[model samples]
Target: MEHLKTFLLKRFRIKDLGDLKYFLGIEFSRSKKGIFMSQRKYALDILQDSGLLGACLDNFPMEQNLKLTPTDGALLHDPTKYRRLVGRLIYLTVTRPDIAYSVRTLSEFMHQPRKPHWDTALRILKYVKGTPGQGLLFPASNNLALKAFCDSDWGGCRATRRSVTGYCVFLGNALISWKSKKQTNVSRSSAEAEYRAMANTCLELTWLRYILQDLKVLQTVPVPLFCDNQAALYIAANPVFHERTKHIEIDCHIVREKLQAGMISPSYVPTRFQLADVFTKALGKDQFVTLRDKLGLHDIHSPT
Candidate 1:
């Protein structure tokens, strides 16, 4: 970059900003082990705006086994406020992926937020308040392997009866991408939901491989994708689809094609080791913290 800057300066004028410290509401810093990224100021502002800056903290964003129904809560007086606040929190998820599941849950009621829904959103803000400085850490290393975990909650949404798909991709030990989204179509079975989530993850892995290729980084090994559902693994590895799986025919084929092509290797993981579960559903505080830590996120100021 320095050499290119010199050559470009000879032809035209440009300014140098040195190394990046902060940009687009995200703070950046370096440590002996790795690079740290956080949205501390942005998160604090959200708490302050919601009058939760001094509020007691919540160890987890949402309650364990928490369920929300559109018809359950009292109608909010101002729907616009709920929309705006949820929008801001969505942006914060760029660095705070730990809150992705909760934000996705809250965003569902944007059209007509109820008092209960707004209360749940406030709970997320409180969770953010407790760990504003916690964020991703990308360590400097030679491990460039691309691996991922894919999981889903079968019909977690009551009103829509739609499954939630979640996956996280890791380049070595650093998390590069993750998503928690409601499937457009309703799945008839848990295996079907898991199969669809695996298909989504396979496509994402393929795209990331192409991006790495564009940067001249070659991935020689087949990407390994871990799924907790044994039935889903069997479906991916099997080419034969039966009566029950007819509902998920397309997804089954997509995953099978990827597996046959050696683009991705599907493996079984136990529920306790499934990192993507945190993204797929509301979790207890103990479980949330364990997986969040596994994502390589920690407070930058905390003692090692």
Candidate 2:
């Protein structure tokens, strides 16, 4: 960057900021204890502007077992407003991953959202209203093992029948990356979908592990990749395959090779302790709160 800057802006005045405190719409605060990222002020402003600052909040971001379908009967008269609102919420996920899945799911119906979809978006806003200060926290830790949890909602989409792939990566206890996207291809079985999800997560995990190694944080001890499906775990552990999983894409099998070579170890975790469950589906209030607390987030009031 210095070399390029010298070439292009040779005579331009520039101030050298030693460290990055904030960038790209995220505010970063570092202290001796830990690093914290919050959009508290921005979230509050958005809530007030959306007329949800005083609304009754729901326990969960979205209702469980709710399947959204195409709005065939009587589409919304003004979907542009809903689309714009959801778009802003999508950007808010930079500091607020708690609403990632809900925002992503709501963003899917941007074209012709109905009243139900709009209400779901409003419900998420209401939930965010009550918890505007929620954000990611990174504690100072020497243990930098790149742990990842990958899961998929098998045939979760009601209209397209496409599964949802969700994953979250942790640098020790700090969550650095997460995603909730609809699968591009139709999967035949749940195991196949999960295998693909793990494969995608492996791509990210491998890249992050490389970057961390470059920064000399931790030597890549076989990254512990957790999944809840036994069949998918077996598929990653063993190279052989039966008729059920043969049709899965070859790219998805790369994680198997990584496992065999000791780059990563696929482990089975029960759904109760699965943190990735929050990203893949709409969870109940108890489960959501449990996982949120486990993510190292707390109410940081100063000497209350």
How much lDDT does each candidate structure score? Answer: 0.90, 0.82
Q: For candidate 2, lDDT tens digit of each residue in 43-117?
A: 777788888777887867888877777764457898888988998898888877788999989988887898889
Which residue pairs of candidate 2 clash?
none
Q: What TM-score, to 2 decimals, does candidate 2 have?
A: 0.90
Candidate 2 global lDDT: 0.82
Model 1: colliding residue pairs: none
Q: Give the Å error, residue 164, model 1.
A: 0.2
Best by TM-score: 1
lDDT tens digits by residue: candidate 1, 173-229: 999999999999989889989989999999899999999999988888889899999
Q: Where does model 2 exceed 4 Å of error?
A: 1-12, 16-25, 299-304
How does each model score on TM-score?
Answer: 0.97, 0.90
* Candidate 1 off by > 4 Å: 10-13
